[model samples]
Target: MFKWASYFLCSFAVLASKGSWATLQDNNQTVCILKDAPNQCGSFCLSALDPMQTNLDAIERKQGVITSQLWALISRQDVQQKSLPSLDYELRRHTEMQEKHISHLLAVQSEMQALQKEMLHSILDVYKKLNAHQTLVQESLDKSITKEVFENRLEGVDKQLLTIGSTMAILMSRSVDQPHTVQNQSLQSPQASLQESLSEIGSEPPQFEQIGSRHFFIEHNLRLNWTMAAQRCRQIGGHLASFQNRLEFNAVTAKLLTGDVYYWIGMNDLGQEGQFVSVASGNPVAFFDWGYGEPDNLGGNHDCVDIAHAKMWDSKCADEERFICQSDNEV
Candidate 1:
């Protein structure tokens, strides 16, 4: 189509130069045909350009629509691009928080484990002490007698002495009136004969071991429950022994026992689960020698205390044991 327009314009320029049909002028920007004579060239050129003008206007309107759509697409892309940084920030923040929470949880778990391990060790230590003392206690009990039997034996001996002393006294009084020479004989008085007989028997009452102005005793030949032992001590004008210091505890404990055995002390928590008091003084114990993890109160029945190997342990109150009696009275 452009070739046809060019061919017609060139032909019109040639026809105007050669014939008296039209005048042609070049204004540098466009070609113009002067209608000096009534010429059809200019009119044909105008008619040709009119159709192309309409097509150009439609193309311009289409270009404007495309430009508007392109701008809208760019705007949407800009909005999406602007949101990425904030999304990344939120993701990073959540990750950091989660990491911190995990770290804290791990730390707490470690602490709990440490505490549990320590507790287990403490329990094991207590159990070892308990087992050792229990075995010794059992052995001691096997070699011991009940307090009642021991007392009965002593009472019988006393009765025998009383009768013998009376008989000797009567016989000596009669011999004194007769006046017979007794040579190389030492039986002169009833008290002397009684003492000689007692010496021959080689029996003496249980004596307390004393240290630092304190007297305490435990008969290895006696086995009694905690309550009975305490009652027996009271009957003997004393109470179950309580220690004021380590020196007194050690001194009395070392000498008062003939063999290894757990001995009941005055210390007990019968009135309260965790509070120990001495029955002798009825006050809180002034000293303590509790073994590791002691007073665990196994079975919740261990309100009494036993002293063994210089350490205190909780024991069942009803269990029989050897016990020391303490008396502050001067002998």
Candidate 2:
């Protein structure tokens, strides 16, 4: 019996080491309750409990390692939760800043548009004023031109009337002096006799003096302004006398009587100051016969040329003087 107990103890010890002690306890519990098998069965049950206790201790250590890992995971999750509100606040601030920038840009655009509209209005107003001023200037210039034309026409009419009155006065004076002589001469048809009497009493034709290729007529009895002298010359199919050289000037001056009177020549500086030109040919005066600093453009108004004592001098165009006319006999 001692040898069997020793063998059972050794076997139980081997099973406990192998970790199968709980199965052995369930199978041998009824045997351990018998009085005859109490000591050996209790010993066997105690040996089996030892292996179960060791197995329970190893399982508890593995559970403690798993709980520690779960706690670490919970701590990380809490930290992430704590940061969420700060991140949300930063995002909201950025959005508000962007909205304010957009509002400022819109306001600047509106102000620029308003300034541009005001500038356009100011420019339009200036343009209207300039247009009105230009219209007024044009109207004033047109009225001035019309008045000048009317005055010139009236002057021409008055000159013609004066010429006709002078001719009628001369004819009436001749008729009063020779009334019986005019009646005796009208024995033929009244129209033929009247025509003959008119031809006899009319002004005589102008006598011309020939020099070179030109014919000249000196009107010593007529004293007129430069403009009127030129007109009278044109009436006789001639222009104001113009000399080409000193010889022709001397010849013309020799024909005139020496006195205090001056005769108008064709040269004038009316076109431009200091540039004497011939009124007949519209050419610069190549021949200068100025008498001792006489053409100093006296008083800045002496624009006409005159001959005095065979020398040329500048004179006012309004001065009334006798003038000579010349015709191109070659034509």
Candidate 3:
């Protein structure tokens, strides 16, 4: 019995040892590959390495994408930060300059407006004064003349008025381009119309002439003797009728100065010897064209007498002649 048991134990121990050695040998064999067995070991290694390499490559690509995105974000942030102050500064500067310019423009407009107002007021005052003077002069002349003579004088005055009208028209046209002055200028046309209306009312009824312009009725019945005529005219704001050029003389002659009766004229050798002085201007009569031997101081006592009707003699201070006055349309 003891012998059998010992043999059994020994055999069991040997079998156990053999099994352990076989397992170890199998593991070693798997670990140790033959150099020519590349198809087996190489395939195994390549498969594992390929998976690892693919994972690494994917990771690297993800990293590169992330870095590029980050850089783009950073560049955008930098540009915004740099431009913010510059854009803000430019905006502020533009706003400030605009405000200044607006203020300056307002100031200039105010000054120009004030200047225009001043000029308008001044012009209005001058126009009023001129109108008043004309009225007074016209009234005086009306009170001293014969109808025919007054009518004729009115015609002559109308001619002079035409010249003044033309001059005023020219002045207005010249000022048309000045819009700043237009406000006052616009008022003048109506004012002139009023003055003309007043003139029409004050004068005798108008008469249409064939060759020349129309004539207003004369303010006749202001007859005075020779010397008294001039004195009255002066007191009332006029003077005895004065002759200018040959044309004017002819016009007067054609109109009939005082019917057939001799009448006084405004011309006389008052200033320097042989030179005639107009009572109106108190200046030399540069336009005088006397009849033959006129103011030859002919009668020696003819200190003031001149040819009247039909080349006859009339007293210098005689109130027989109609009175006339001179004035400017504009102040």
Off by over 4 Å in 2: 1-205, 329-331
Give lDDT per model, in order.
0.73, 0.74, 0.54
The sequence of per-residue lDDT tens digits that candidate 3 reaches over residues 97-201 is: 999999999999999999999999999999999999999988887787767998888999999999878877765543332223323333457644433333332
lDDT of 2 by residue, 175-251 (tens): 44443334434235554354344334324546678976567988887788897777556545677878887777777
Q: Write the per-residue lDDT of candidate 1 for residues 214-303, one digit (tens) a residue.
A: 887775666678887776565455788888888887777676454457888788998988999988988888888888899899998999
* CA displacement after TM-score superposition, residue 264 of candidate 2 (Å): 0.6
Looking at model 2, residue 184 earns an lDDT score of 37
TM-score of 1: 0.38
Q: Pick the candidate with the highest TM-score.
A: 2
Over the full model, what C-alpha lDDT does candidate 1 score relative to the true structure? 0.73
Q: Sort the predicted structures by TM-score, highest score first.
A: 2, 1, 3
* Residue pair clashes in candidate 1: none
Count of steric clashes across candidates, in order = 0, 0, 11
Show where candidate 3 strays beyond 4 Å: 1-66, 143-150, 153-331
Instruction: Give the Cα error of residue 265 in candidate 2, in Å.
Output: 1.0
lDDT of 3: 0.54
